[model samples]
Target: MHFQFDDRLNSFRQEVRDFVAANLPAHIVNRQRHKSFAPDDLHTAEWQAILHKNGWSVPGWPLEYGGTGWSPLQQFVFNDECAAADAPVFPWGPRDMVGPIIYTFGSDYLKETFLPMIREGRHYWCQGFSEPGSGSDLASLRTTAVRQGDSYIVNGQKIWTSGAAVAKWGFFLVKTDTSGKPQQGISFLIIDMSTPGISVRPIQQMDGDDHLCEVFLDNVAVPVEHLVGEEGKGWTYAKDLLDHERTGSSYIFWNKRELAKAREIASSETIDGIAVIDSEPFRSRLARIEAQLTALEWSVLRMLADEQTPWHPSALASCLKVRGAQLQQSITDLQMQAMGRKSLRFIAPQQMADFPVSTLWPDYLVGKTSVALITRAATIYGGTLQIQRTIIAKMAFGV
Candidate 1:
C-alpha cells in the first residue's frame, strides 16, 4: 500500500541513471535523444552486455534467473530512468517476453540452452504468433507442425514478425491438431532461423525500415524438445506470453520521454512571433497530454502494484493498451506539430544509416519524422485499438 519509493528503490534508480550516463556510448545516447525508432543491432548488443556485466540486464525477472531481483516498483524506476537517460530499448522477447514463458514452462534442456544465451544477449529472438490471417484472431493461425518421431515438419507463413530477418530463433504457435476447437489444437514451438526450409523476406515499412518480415516455413523440421509445455496447450502459453506483452504495451516509458521531447521542441521553437510553448493552444494541448499521461502512469502502477485487484490482469492490460496506443500516436502527432514545417524534412533510412547525427540536420531533427510516421502503426501492431476495445468489453463486462 506504499505510494512512494522507499530509500532502497530511490538509490537503485540513481544507480541506474549513473550507470547509463557512464557506460552508454555517446553516439547511442544521441540517436536515442533524437527519438530513433529503434537502436541498431550493434548498440543493442553492446548495451545489453554492459547491463549483464552489471547484473542489471533483466530487472523484472527472478534473481535465480540472472535477474536483479528488484521489486516491481524498482523495475519501474529502472525503466523510467533508462527512458529519461535516452537509453536504447531493452531486448524484450529474449529477456522478458518469451524468457519467462520458457523458464516457467520449458523443459530443463530448453532452459539450459536458451536461458544463458538470453541472459548474455548472444542471440536475438522474435515472436512468431501472428500469421497473415491470424493477427488478433491468433487461434486461426494456419501454421502446422506434424510430429514425426524426433522432429516435426512445420509449414506455413508468418507476417509482421519484428526482427525475423535477423533473429536466430523464433517462438511460434503451430497447429498440432485440427480436430479439436480452434484454440485447443495449437502447440508452442521454437524453430531455428537457419533451418533449411525457412526463408525470411523483409517487408519494407512505410517508415522506411525493413525490420518487419514475412517468414515462409516450408517443411521446416523442428526438434520436439523445442516445444514449450505440451502439445494442445499452446493456446494457454500464447495467452500467457501475450498477457505479459500487453502489460508492457502500456508504454509508460516511451510516453513519458516523448512528452518531454514535445515540451522541449515547443519551448525551443516559435509560432508566428511567440514560442510554441507560450502559445495558448499549444499549452492547452500539452496540458491535456500530460494529464492523460499522469492518469496512465497511475493505472500502470496500480496494476503492477497489485495484480489481484477487482479487474482481471488481461482486462486491465487491454484498457492500458487502448489508452497507451492512443497516447503514443497523440504524443507523436504533437511532436510533429512542435516540429512544424521542419517535420517535413524527410530523411531516408539509408541516409540516417550512412551518416552521423551531425552530417544530417541538428540531432533533435534527425529521426523526428520517421518516429512520427511509425507511431501511426502503434495502435495496429500490439492487438490494434479496436481489438483491445473488444477485449475490454468481453473481459470487464459480461456480454
Candidate 2:
C-alpha cells in the first residue's frame, strides 16, 4: 500500500489547517499549544458547532451517519492537522465512541434520535464502563440494571468517567444477569445524565483540573429503548468501543508537536555557555525520540491500510499506546529538565494572572510544569500500561 498522502488527502489537510488558522479561538489554541485543556461548556459547544457546520465533525464515520466518509488515510491526515493546530479535542463520546456503536447496533429509532444530535454537538456522551473496582478487568464491573416492566433500574457507581460532570448522556455497561459468566451477563444501555437518582461529583486531579468524575446511579431508571443491541451482549459492544478508543489513544500528533517544541526550547536556550541543542547528550535524545515518532507514524498508517482485515491482532494499537504514553511523559520530563528551576514555579488557576513566567517565557510555557505532571497519568488511563503489555503479550507473541 502507498504511504504517501494522495492529492485529495493533502488538499483536505490543507483545508483543515486553513480553517483552524482562521477560526480556532485564541484561548483554545493557547491552551493546546501549552498542553493545557480547560474546556468551557459554552465555548466548547460553539467550537464543535463550527466543525459540524463545516462537515468536519465526523471524519472517520460512514457518510450516511453524518460522517465525512473520508478514507482512513484521510481521517489520519485531518486529525494530524487538527492536533498540530491545537484544535479542540473532539468530544470522543459522540464522534469516536458511542456514535459508531449506535449506527452499528442501535435500532433505527435510536439512530434517528441520536446520530443527528451527536453530529450537531447537541449531545455529549461519557463511557460508563469502569466501576470503582473494575478498571483493567472490565468484566468484573458490578453495576446492575434489572429490568422492570418497560424500563431498567440501574444501580451502582462508575469511577473516572472523563466527562460525566458535563455530559448530557452516558452509555453504560450493566450486569443484567449474574447466573451466566462475567462477560456474558452484560448489556449496554444509554442513560440520560439528568435522570433522577443519578449524581455526578467531580474529582480534582493533581493538576487542579476537575476533568474526571465519579457517577452514582442510585436506582436511576432508563427506558428499555435505550438498550443499543440485544440484551446480555454488552461485552461485545464494549470491546468494539474500546478498540476504537485504544486506536486513538496513541496521541501521536500531540506527542510529535510537543517534541518539536522541546527541540525549539533546546535550540533557544544555553546551559554552561553551550546551547542545549548543541550538547551531544540532548541532541542524541532528540534523535531517539524523532526516530521513534517516525516509526509510530508509519505503524498507524499500517493499521489504517489493514482496516479491511477482520480479527487483526491490534498489536500496533497496544504497542503505540505503550510507547506513546511513555514518550509523552518522557518528552515532558525533558522539557521540565531543560527549563531547570524555571519549572519549579507551579501556578494555580487563581495565580495565573500574576504568574512571573509570563514575562520570562511565552504564554505557551505558562502551564508546562502542570502539563508535564499530568502526563504521568497517561499510561494509567485508556487502560493501564500493564494491561496494554498483557495485550501485546497475547496478541503479538501468541502466548
Candidate 3:
C-alpha cells in the first residue's frame, strides 16, 4: 500500500502542524517534551476542546458524526505531523474507542446524546473491562448487570481501568446470563459516573503517576437503552471494541516521535568524550530500531488502506503491539545507558517547579528511572509478550 502522502494530504498535514504549533498550550507541550509524560485531564480537555472547535479531533469518524472525513493517508499524515510537533495526545476514550462503537451500533437517540458531547470535549470515557481475575481472559469476568424492569443493576469491579478516576462515563462489559456459554453470556453497557453506587480508587504506578485505577459498581443502575449491539451478544461487541483497540495500538505516531528523540540524544551525547553517534554498536542498534519502526508504520498503513472483508490477521496486531512496546523499552534503556550515572540520580516532583534548570539532561530525565521502571510493564499490559506470542502461534502460524 502507498504510505507516502500525496500533495493534498501533505497540505492537510501542514495545516494540522500549523494549528497545533500556533494553538496548543505551551505548558502542555512542556509536560510532554520535558517531562516525558502524557497530559493530565486539564491539559487534555484544553487541547481537545481546541481540536474539537476546529473539527480536527475526529478524523477517523464519519463526517456526519463530526469527523473530518480525511482519507486513510490523510489520517496517517495528520497523526504523524501532530505527534512530531509534540502536540498533547488527545484523550482517546472519546475519539478512539467509544465514538466509533457508538457510530456503528448506537440508536439515533444514543448517538444524539453522546456524539456531540464527545466531539465538543464535554465528556470523558473509560473502558471497564479488566477485573481482578478476568483481565486477559475477559470471558471469565464476574461483573454482572441483572435486568430489573427498565434498568440493570450492575455490581462488580474493574481493575487497571485507565483514567477512570477522572472519567465522566465508561463503557463496560458485564455478564447478563449465567446459563449460556461464557463468551455468549456477556453484554455491553454504558454507565454515567454520577450513578449511585460507583466509586473510583486510583492505582499508583511505579512512575508515581495515577493513570490506572480500580472502579467499583455496587447496584449501579444503567438504563436498558444503554446496551450496545444486542443482549447476550455483548461478547461480539466487546471483541469489536478490542479489535479497534488493537488496530490502533500499533503506536505509530508516538513511536515515530520517540525514535526521533532517541536519535536526537544519540546525536548530542558523547561516550568517553567521543560522540556516541560515531560508535558502531550504538549506531547499529539505532539503525535496527528505525528499520523496524519503518516496517511497522507501513504495516499499519497497509491495514488502513485495505480495511475490507478479509480482516487483517489478529496475530499481526499482537506482533506490532509486542514489538512497539519492546522497542519503546529498548529506546528508553539505550537513553539511560547513554546518560550513565547521571540517570541514577533522582529528581523529586518539587524540583519540576524550577523549570529549565541547568541539568545535564532534560527535566523529564528527573524521573527517567521512574519512567523506565514503569515501561518494564509495557510488554505485560494490554496483554503480555507471552500472550502475543501465543496469538502469533495459533493464528498466524496456524498452530
Candidate 2 per-residue lDDT, tens place, 102-141, comes to 9999999899989888878886678888888899999999
- Pull out the clashing pairs in model 1: none
Cα lDDT computed for each candidate against the true fold: 0.84, 0.81, 0.78
Off by over 4 Å in 3: 1-3, 36-39, 307-312, 348-356, 359-361, 364-367
Candidate 3, residues 1-399, lDDT tens digits: the string is 445766876787778778878988888777665453434667667777888888887888898888887877777788788788777676667778788888898888779989988887776688898899997787999999999999999999999888898889899989999887899889988899889899999897766677789999999999999987688887887667657766567767877877776676667677798777778888888888888888888777777677553433678788788888887788777767666676676554334445554546655455556666667877877788888889888887778
Query: What order do you get sorting by lDDT, best first?
Result: 1, 2, 3
* Poorest lDDT segment (10 consecutive residues) of candidate 2: 31-40
lDDT score, candidate 2, position 275: 80
2 or 3, which is superior by lDDT?
2
Deviation (Å) of 233 in candidate 2? 0.8
Q: What is the descending TM-score order? A: 1, 2, 3
Q: In model 3, what are the clashing residue pairs, if there are any?
A: none
The TM-scores, one per candidate, come to 0.95, 0.92, 0.92
lDDT of 1 by residue, 261-291 (tens): 8998888877687888988888899999999
Candidate that would win on lDDT: 1
Prediction 1 TM-score vs. true: 0.95
